[model samples]
Target: MPTPGGYALVHDRTIVAERRTCRFSWVLVDSGNNINILYRDTMTQLGIEATHLQPTRMLFHDIVSGLSCSPVDRIRLDVLLGTNDHFRRGPIWFEVVDLSSPYHVLLGRPALAKFMAVPHYAYLKMKLPGPKGLITVVGDYKKSLECAKAGSKMAESLVVTEERRQSTGS
Candidate 1:
């Protein structure tokens, strides 16, 4: 059984300590004194009792707010990560804050932190924000989660459109 705080995946937990990566200098993965963060299981995935993990909802404009009014706006984002860092790489329905840029997916602190995993060139290997490797909901995809039947289909269509753009540079 997978726990809510931590998961059972090796790839997701594994880290490249020696590597140097830094894509978002804007963010930081710090565990300094008084950080009170769990000493083990990465800073976010606390092995300690002091570090409390907070769960929150994210809208489309949360993370991608920086890309507003841009041509790449309105692109449906693969919910690369979700609240509680459970879901990864799937269609996440988020409310758009700005109509001009519908495709830009928002990145809350959670998404920013998780996707930062794996060092880029000169940063601490970011811990996996969401489920990084093989994750199966292990229930009913159609029954338990069906309200999304309509949105899921729409997301699929958007994905196709993005794929085409990536392949043809259009």
Candidate 2:
């Protein structure tokens, strides 16, 4: 098990784990390109086989409630430790917390509180310091940014030019 702030060197570059409960067995994702995971070939990769993994309420750290009481089945992931700020102590504990409806889980100021979160924007590469070990966040920023820019431009114009090119903002 890797310690906090420690990197799990795999192949050449360090690899972070991407764990999720799919419709089949639990999946463990590794490698950026040509991704590999611990799952049988015949699987949907979302919920359990035959049955769909519907959103269900589960107990997570209650930041506001302080103690664990209100358990929610929100898909949003809540970061416990590894936030930007840290005292003499090391990273903090993480829990699968949830929030009420309407407040979408986004990389806003609060969600991006962790110093590593912004890296996801550039490449979605965030170093998540878990209790057992540190997991690197692998993300692609350039591609997403370009896609978003194009989408917004299209939304604003709602018209395709002869060259299908967008006019530079004047």
Candidate 3:
């Protein structure tokens, strides 16, 4: 079983696309896993034009819950992480999806492979090999807990709103 604080690896990230930038405090830097994900609303906020983009059908499942989520459409975009000099990365392709996760983005195996990152969950640090040398990113445990709390509240509200709508037949 993972420690309670192991989830702190989820931290802030800056995503740039089409010369537009969006900073998200809830970006999950997963381990060596291929679960790259992007929030639909976040993509829109970043000014990533989706109308012209083709959507691909994909299925996602919640491993912990053993439940299948709705099949979501995937949209591709070129995105960059961090800034230019110090902790910069990408122009890499990302597949966008609509997921109500607390995270705005989930950096998975591909990203980990690209940066050759080593994640230390206990220390809440992610180390990567930069062009010049090694770069380290520290996660904020408090922020992760705060975001999780907020997400849970939002989810509860959504459920209540849905129940009300169904009861009213609107």
Candidate 4:
């Protein structure tokens, strides 16, 4: 069993591309998620054109709203984890979506399985096997709190805006 407040704690880390073209500052580590997700804005920041993305007909169901959301596209990128001396690199497929989020990317079970990474939410640490040895990545507590708070605010704002739209019938 996991300890309380784990949900409030954000599990994020820096992810570098094998090509060294771009680096993601905050990537949410979600073990419960089945698929990896990337924001369109982040893809744009990486200088990846929309035309490069492959079309995806998959739709994700939102647990909170029970609504189905379609992804803009899908992309495969080679991501490197950990430091230069000890790192794991692999190709991860991400469903690109246009939304407002606190983190740049959401790394789910697929990403974890690819790297064989184990995440401890309470401790805010993730460990994976590297060529030299085990590579451990620690999460920033301050950044976690900040991202959680921001996410909460964004959710609240969205709900309020939705309610207003419903009331206005527009």
Note the residue pairs that clash in candidate 3.
33-109
- Top TM-score model: 4
Better of 1 and 2 by TM-score: 2
What are the TM-scores, per candidate, against the unseen true structure?
A: 0.20, 0.27, 0.74, 0.87
The residue-level lDDT of candidate 4 at 146 comes to 73
Best by lDDT: 4
Instruction: Give the range of the ten consecutive residues with the poorest summed lDDT in model 4.
Output: 11-20
Q: Cα-based RMSD of the predictions, in order?
A: 17.9, 15.7, 4.1, 2.9
- Residue 103 lDDT in model 4? 84
What is candidate 2's lDDT per residue for 28-58, written digit by digit as tens? 1122212111111212222223232124443
- Which is better, 3 or 4, measured by TM-score? 4
**Per-residue lDDT of model 3, residues 52-78, tens digit only:** 445665566652244455425555444
- Give model 4's TM-score versus the native structure: 0.87
Q: Order the candidates by TM-score, highest first — what do you get?
A: 4, 3, 2, 1
Candidate 1, residues 12-39: lDDT per residue as tens digits? 1221111221121112222221111111
In order, candidate lDDTs are 0.28, 0.29, 0.67, 0.77
Q: In candidate 2, which residue ranges exceed 4 Å CA deviation?
A: 1-105, 114-124, 141-146, 158-170
**Rank order (by lDDT, best first):** 4, 3, 2, 1
**Candidate 1, 155: how far from true, in Å?**
1.3
Q: Please write out the lDDT profile of model 4 over residues 1-170, one tens digit for every residue.
A: 24434643244344434333666657788888888888888887777778788999878887236346788999998777888677788899999988788888888899999999988877888899999999998776777767888888887887788788889999
